[model samples]
Target chain A: MSSQSVVFIGAGNVATHLAKGFYQAGVDILQIINRHFDKAKNLADQVDAQPADDLNSLMKDADVYVVAVQDDAVQNIVKDLSLPRGTLVHTSGTVPLSQLSNAAPESGVFYPLQTFRADQELDLTQAPICLEASSSETYQQLKALASTISNQIHPVDSEQRKTIHIAAVFLNNFTNHMLACAEELLSKHNMDFDLLRPLLEETWQKVRHHKPSDVQTGPAMRNDRQVITEHLDRLKNEPELQAVYRVLTESIQRKYS
Target chain B: MSSQSVVFIGAGNVATHLAKGFYQAGVDILQIINRHFDKAKNLADQVDAQPADDLNSLMKDADVYVVAVQDDAVQNIVKDLSLPRGTLVHTSGTVPLSQLSNAAPESGVFYPLQTFRADQELDLTQAPICLEASSSETYQQLKALASTISNQIHPVDSEQRKTIHIAAVFLNNFTNHMLACAEELLSKHNMDFDLLRPLLEETWQKVRHHKPSDVQTGPAMRNDRQVITEHLDRLKNEPELQAVYRVLTESIQRKYS
Candidate 1:
């Protein structure tokens, strides 16, 4: 596996982290390819890989070609790439494996299921890499590649991967938005957001051992109309927040009561 | 401070945890008072304190009286209590110190800033205890009591405490609701919510060092309408979740863009 080389087709957060992880795992990263030459070079320097500005420079002998661009950019990039059959794969949860079918006969998905920030170093050992391929041999190759970095790997079909991606949106994207709303609410009252850190930590810890529905607690869970009314009244000035508050409150009440 | 005997007015989640903390810190828990005799006796047995079903059995010699009842019940319980002047404090963030003022002249607050579950044992040493008192001497005594269990103590005023509580609702209550929504979405798709554990852990870990706003990532933050629309479509049958998704998406867009 170490002898089999790979080339990354983007220099974004996902690409940077995946490139670093693959490099650390002793897989030879052959090149960093991107339209933006400087960004490609930047990541290339970190992984000790050559930077290429266009598809014309792509290494044809590489065992794997990972397209880790934005979801919308994936199809276009894969279509333009001239990789050998079964060598090209895209790293997207929502995009279907069929999207890659037009680009290469042996296309697959190597989606890492975690949020990536270029500035922050993530431990990929714990991240689940969802894999899907057009053929079993291609899957075995992708699994071998993914197993180099992550211990948790799953073979999910295209439809299930899309479902997982939607779940990811709810868990990561929407949850982060909730935190941002929390920070905004705290800022308006001149309260330190740090004050909520312990509770935030505790909330995450609870879900690790208990079912979220079983562990849910709040004014709405208890059907405490007085407290809910008080909270809603407090949010009168912020109509958007008030809508969120009311909808979630109603949902929680329906679930519990 | 170990010699300072205290009486708890309720044996709910907050009362149980605080009593355990105080008892562990070597402060003598003199009595556990609750309307329900079984609960009072149950908590009293654990803390090695006397159990009382009514305020008529309240210990007059106790140095500090902690009213840890429900929010609406605080004033009523405090008013009915018969204790020495300046010995009363209520552990409520939203309830004003003045509520206890009518019950005792030296009333204050000893509110711990963390979520508590009756069945879960939490280490109070790391939990922030917000203190407020009517007089300097009472404040000093409450501070001393708080220092015995927790190192993080803050002298927050009534208005500020209310603001803090509201912020807590947003951070803890609403955030848990978001996790619940995520779990529900996964359950519908026959996907394991455990698949989200790493992402959830990462989200909390990221916000610890960075402002949630600075670290926010999602389709909404990136203004990726295609993915957002796909997610909304997936949640078509669940209108309540769709409302939550739309409002949060709009909020994130407003904040970032």
Candidate 2:
């Protein structure tokens, strides 16, 4: 709607969401390029944009170039990109904004700090979009572009963004593994995994408003050795789970102690 | 309303919620008893029931006696209680139902599977109320009392209930600690913890429907050594967080590998 045409360099989950978000915001999606032509075409078709597998014939007149590839692939893709005049951005939490300096005169970061699933539809309007740029002008441009989809825009540097990324690993990856462990334990006992849902729901409800440490309850937090020991004995058959249980118990105990 | 009178044996978080829930379901709460008379009276005031600090005048005519005490205290409380009639049930996940056998002729387990906070208002209507009893008559009584508040009732033995309790530690306690870790990391960097809420929201949304292992995304899941190493290096100053990060990362890597 603002006459700022954009091209996405990857058609992954992040790119798919961003492209659809932009398209719905009335921005002209110039192209969608991926290493796999099918993937590019698949996403581009939804956004009503051209699809290209090769980087050689990239759109030269776009207002912005979004490099949404994997963190490892971003450097090579940006290095090889030959944009005549457009601000380049990478939607990554870890990668620095400077990585796109060679791709365009203007570079920035537009990281939406949420886990994306290829099959699941995510409304990005409320997700925190952490931004960093090489210049003030580029920052403003990136901010304006991000405003189209999300209002939770934050200006974070590379170091701070890396910290957030690491924190996210703890919040998302590790917490999810904990749930997986619960599922495995329940399934082994022939108990319904669905039985754990209300507890899970209540836990997150508390998490939304209270500090995890303040609301923390369990044998570990209470330092109940009897319960802790009994739980350890129950998990003795699964050494891997026992190790995880022991470490987490020790960590919680140490934190509170 | 069904002429089944109830008496609560503790005024802790579990007792507070259960007592209130039963009162709302039109069940008669004859007395609320706790070691602390003030705590007992505080909850009794809400349900229009009598409060007592001692077990000397426990209502013998009440159809159900609910022991909502700590794991270690259950045996002693049940041992000391002089009940003339009615089913005696303990709301504990770890304590075996047999512990109540000496307290009453009709003994049963009426454990509500949830982490209760005294301040929070919880709807027990959907939470799993696990039941185990010495006789079919006791089971039916507990089930009817449980059904007055919750539709989710399960008949689980001590061993299975213990397994669920252990699993709950992983799901709620450890998972909450992970969020605490994230809060600490973010706070040290002067970042608002609220920024992490959307990610937390989306993570739980995915968790509600999918197997956690399937929806997992992070360096550990992918075994991205570079990112993992970078993150570990960042946590060099915080040894506790570093240990947790390393253990969780290794666990995820081992799980996938």
Candidate 3:
């Protein structure tokens, strides 16, 4: 298992983080493949792996061909790969496991469930790696590879993975947009965005211990119509934000009342 | 300043935390007044202060009288207080400073900008206290009392404080509801909420260093209609959640595209 090799088919944020994690965990990275030769070479140098501009140049002998490309590009990448059956996998949550059937008989998914930034250091050990495969043998090999970098390995099928992915968007992507809206609101009032940092930190802390509903507080939760009116009135200048406030307020009210 | 005394006119979450912080900072908590005698007695015992079940029993000589009641009750409590013209203050974000003008001449605000739970211990040093007063002298006095517990004190007016309060809702309360929605979505699939903890922690970490807009990522931000369609289709059963998803998706698309 320690001698298992993985070839990354994309040099993106997920690929960069996964490559570093696998390299540190003693998994051999045989090659970095991407349409952009410079980007491929950049990641290859970091992991001491060979760089290939296309699948034709990829080393087919690697135990795993991790196609960590965009969701749309995943199928094309898989179709071009001339790897042995049961050796190809992609890091996607929405794409079905059956999408890999034409490429290999034993294809699977090796998805890491965390947002990645190329400039920031990622602690993969803390992230849960989701594994799915067409066959039990492929699942075992994928689980073994995931276990090297993370203790939390989940055997989630494509359907369940899609559910997790959508939820992640709500928690991570939508929540970040809320922060942006807050920043914009504060800046318009000449207030520092730093003023809300402690509150934001505490919000996360509360969810970690209590259910979000049990710990819910604010105008809508309390049914304080006055405060809700004031906030909505303030947001009237921005119709989009006003709509967001209205929908969320109605949602919270429905949940509580 | 060490001889400064304050009378708290409530025993709820904010009042309890503020009283404890002032007591720890060596400010004398003269009394705890509440309509609920048992709650007043409970907080009074913790701070070694006298407990009063009515405003008539409240100590009149305290340097600052902190009326930390609910938003709707603030004005009523202030009008009922039989204190000196320049000693009454209230802790509210949206309520104006003028709300206390009829109750006292030296009315001011000592609003701490943090969410509180009575059962949880709060470190005031990290929470900024927003201060406001009718007079410069009163402002200095209120600032001095707030400085005892927290180093971060901002002299924000009623108008600006209202704006900050609205923005805080967007960041803290609304973002939390988003987490609740995510939790509900995950639970429907029999998934463990712990799987999203690392992602949540990382989301907060990223905001601490980068602008939310600069770090934004997802199907909405990328304008990937396919993934968005898949997510919305999955959420079809929960119409409320589906509306929220569509609104947020449209909001993100508008922001980025």
Candidate 4:
């Protein structure tokens, strides 16, 4: 495959991470476009790419236009953008691919299945790529492109991608919040949060090898009314946490029963 | 400097994890007692201790009797048991140290800061030890025992421990629950849950060196109403998750604001 020029249209965390990942993978970023001129400059400078805030200027020679923006803005960005026909894709979990259906050089999704934080570095090799295209030929090109950066590639459609994102929230966001809650409670009691780190890490590790429902522990899963009541009483003021407690406890019990 | 014989009351997660940690640190486990004889025997076998179903049998010749029972039963167990004064402790975060005051043996708390599942191997070296004792000498003994297992020890009274427990909820249970919620939402759309693992891991990793409020990420932290709304609407039927979304979004906002 010949080296194709890639264009990044966002300068946010995901954009920056993906830009860097692509740069490392030998994809010559033709240009980086952002609403904010300085943001586009910063990202372009980091990746040694041409910085162009106006989409029209970069669209002249862009082989691929990657719309790496917020979920709500994907359709509008794709619709209003003046990119070449059949040459646009949006990196969104929930947004449909049809938004880029308008003539683009070759539209496709190169969704990186990993979280991005500006301060953290990413290994694109391990990051799964959820690739999709409007047609079979484009799909092959996108798959080839994704394979350049990552070995873990999935040719998933929008619906499947959305489902994966939903699961991610439960496993990542909700789990992290629960960890935060546990930390909050333990810290208030003058107990060290680090104390629970072992058990917490083990909780996830067990689920990695064993089925989650099989390895469920803690008061809720055990149906220990005594501990649950005590913890709930402590969380009485935090209505959100109490509701969480009830739902999770019920879920755990239901899974076991 | 001399090793004293020890009697462990209860064979639950806490007791099992603690006893194994203590035994590794060279404590002599003389007896183990639980409501269920088989459970006690199982735990005792692992720790190389004799298992007994009755109080008198387990208590005989025991230098220290650690009560590791449920919170509600703490008082009852203390009152009904006739252990000789000057060596009793309960491993509870909520129960006051005074609950063991009426008991013959002096009382204190040797709380291990971690969640425990029966199958998970607990690494106490990093586990925080929250300790309080009836006397200075007792405190020294408990401190020595804890030091054998972990270096991170906090001399917390029951009141302080309560605050610590509250903090624990934030760091542990609540954070984990939040992760679960996000996973739930992503799964609804057929998204792979693995996408969030790196993000979740990074969240915890960041806090090891940084403040939670400083390192906050996500739609809530960014104040991205669009993403939040889409996420919430996606979780429309999940009242608990929706409530969590509302509460956590507000909390993160206030925290950063």
Candidate 5:
């Protein structure tokens, strides 16, 4: 019997990270398909796998097909890719795994519960691979594949996967956005941005165990009108940042002593 | 002729941190005075110093007197101290060492360029000490004393110190407010706040060594209209945060490729 092969149905950032992880872990990446032929070929080249421009033409005996595409494209790709019985999966955060039809013999989820970027060096070991399967045997196969790359694996259905995804958005995406805002503000003033690194690192470390509200310190929280007014004056047309300050100060004061 | 004893004119966070730092560095803190003597005495006890409610008594026979009071109180406290040949220093970001007047033997600044909390573990060795003085001898003394506690010391004059302080505000205090806002928005949505930690940490890391513009990432920079709109909608009531997002997005887009 041939070793089980996994197929990637998209070549986005998620696809790149997941495929690279799978390839490095010695799993067979049977085929890669993308709307853009060149992009698919490029990603496949990195993993020593062949590319398929047409989903239907990808030799379809793979044990798993990871539909790691956009949220809008998941269903369309699944409908188009006439996969082997129960051998379809989608890696999405917000999308429910059950959206894939039951007619597909082995549909499931292999959503990595972490942010993925093409250039970023993500330690897959820290990723909690959330897996859900239509059948127990498929579930075990997904688990086995996930275990090769990640130390953390969670047996989660669509509902639980979404809750985890929501939590991740709060933890990763929005937080990064906040940092980006800080960077922009700091640069405007010709300051050593590094001055903030220790503080940001400290802030994150504190949050690992303590509540966010407890660690908040600044003029607004202390009701230091002078500092607050100075900051507000600096904000100028950036009323949104001021509103954020007001709302956050109010919220923090309410919840904390 | 007797040991160079100093007096502290405020018992606030900075005063307490500085008093503790001075005591650890083997400097003599002869007396501590405050509007609230209990607070002054509490700090004095920590540093093995005496407490004085009377301004004349605190400054009498002192080799140096430090006014670590509020922004507006520094000048008044220095004027009241009337030290005869004793050094007078003010620990403030905005206020100048010259603000203490030439009536004293020497007037200087010993501003530690880091935020201090009453209970937080402050590694003074890592903190920056911005020292300024009315005379060269006084500068050397303050620098030597600061060097005992911190490796990082700068002989920044009043104007330079003020500019650095402004920069500090942009990087530390303002950035912290942005973080607090991130926490508030995420918490209001019933999201786990831990998600923001890693992203914020990474941003700080990148900005430390590289230009913020070079490392900028997010929906705004990418011109991902869809995601930006979604996030903006999510922050509907948070006009301040929304303004922050808009202003920052514009700045990032303008600054980066």
Candidate 6:
């Protein structure tokens, strides 16, 4: 079990990170497969695995075949995949584990619950990996593989994993958009975005310890209509941003008032 | 002067953190003035300063008098404040330095550009302190005083400071509300909030180094209508959340599509 080999079926951010993590953990990586040969080769070269452009060329003997392609392509890839003596898993948050039933007798999910950027370095060793499998045996194998790379391994079902994904949309995607909106507003005013950087850092630091409700503070939280009105007036030019500002402000006021 | 004495006119989060920062830097804290004597006495005890519930009891000979009261109270407080030998400064992001003109010939702003929680420990030494003043001498003195506690001090004017405050509301207040929304969504489904904590940490970590536009990822970023539709359907029971989901999803689509 310790010598279990893994093959990845994508060369994107999720694949690049997980492949590197498995490589660092002394696990044997068999192949890196992508529709684009160069992307496959680039990630494969880094991990000393064979790079393949065709799903037909995948090794049938690997202990695990991880389909890490786009969400729309996951079902098709799994449909074409057939592991001779191994488990198959797709690294997706939204895709259910049952989607892999046509791929292999043993199927599961191996979703790393963190946003990955190909150009940035991510320490997958500390990241939470969500696991779901078709069978108890496959679950144990998936858990073991996940344990090699992460200490925060979670056994989540399809419903729970989807719940986490939606929550992540709010935490990462929506949060980043808020900053992006701020950046746009600052850029329009010719103010340096760096002015808000330290405050951003502090806001995240506070959330790490306290609940969001406990740490909430601002004109909206304090029900300071004057400041809120001024901010709304300031944003009157950009209706989209103004709408966002108004809605978020109203939401905060509703909760606090 | 290195031995200059200061007085604080409020005992709220901003005042408590800044007064402690200056006190730790060995600046003499002469008095803590607040209408609520207990709060003033509590903060004053921490900084080894005298507590006074009366504005008339303020030490006029101090090198600086910091009016760190609420935004609406700042103008009225400055109107009543008459420092005989010290500069008058208000710790506010939106309040103009002109509001303090009648308080003293030398007036300025000493705004720490970070969110503060009174119960939590904040290292003001690393926080950005935005300074604005009525005169060059007062600006230099404020800068010197600010430098004692913070390495990241910038001289931002009233207009720029107000812009920063609006941006802070987005970066801190709006971001926290996003997390609150996620928490509410998860709680409704009997899911643990801790599941998304790691993803939240990584989101902030990525923003520290990369621009938000570059690191943005989600169903909306890819225009995955299926996932987006699914998420919206999941939130259909909560109209407010559903509205947030749609607006944010549309915002992301507008940016990346």
Q: Which candidate wins on lDDT?
A: 2
Locate the minimum summed-lDDT window of 10 residues in model 6 chain B: B76-85
- Candidate 3 docking band: medium
The order by descending DockQ is: 2, 3, 6, 1, 4, 5
Clash count in backbone of candidate 1: 2
Q: What is the iRMSD of the candidate numbered 5?
A: 5.0
**What's the number of clashes in each of the models?**
2, 0, 2, 108, 14, 0
- The digit string of per-residue lDDT tens for model 2 on A133-249 reads 989988888888888999899999999999999999999999999998898889888987789999999998999888777878899998999899989998999788899999999
lDDT per residue, candidate 2, B1-257, as tens digits?
25589999999999999999989989999999998999999999999999999898787899999999999889888888768888998888888887788888788888898989898899899799999998987888888889989999999888999999999999999899999999999999999788999999999898988877777778988888888998999999888899999988988888888
- The per-model DockQ list reads 0.66, 0.81, 0.78, 0.39, 0.23, 0.69
Judging by DockQ, tell me the better candidate of 3 and 6: 3
Error of 5 at A48 (Å): 5.9
TM-score of each: 0.94, 0.95, 0.97, 0.86, 0.76, 0.92
> How are the candidates ranked when ordered by lDDT, highest leading?
2, 6, 3, 1, 4, 5
Q: Model-by-model lDDT, in order? A: 0.84, 0.89, 0.87, 0.71, 0.68, 0.88
Error of 5 at B214 (Å): 2.9
Q: Where does model 1 sit among the CAPRI classes?
A: medium
Isolated chain A: TM-score per model?
0.94, 0.95, 0.95, 0.91, 0.86, 0.95
Please report the candidate that would top DockQ against the real structure.
Answer: 2
Q: Which 10-residue span in candidate 2 chain B carries the lowest summed lDDT?
A: B208-217
Locate the minimum summed-lDDT window of 10 residues in model 5 chain A: A165-174
Chain B TM-score (each prediction, in order): 0.94, 0.95, 0.95, 0.91, 0.89, 0.94
lDDT (tens digit, per residue) of candidate 6 on B1-257: 66778999999999999899889999999999999999999999999999999998877788988999889999878777776778989988887788888878699999898888888888787789999998899889999899889999898889888888888898899999999999888888887778788788788888898777777878898889999998898778888888888888888788677
True contacts kept of 3: 0.77
Instruction: Please provide, for model 5 over A1-97, each residue's C-alpha lDDT reduced to its tens digit, 9 standing for 90 to 100.
Output: 2345888889998899899998998989878888899999999999988898886687767788888987667777766555555378888865666
> How would you encode candidate 3's per-residue C-alpha lDDT over B159-231 as one tens digit per residue?
8898889888888888999988888888888987778888888887888778777888889999999989989
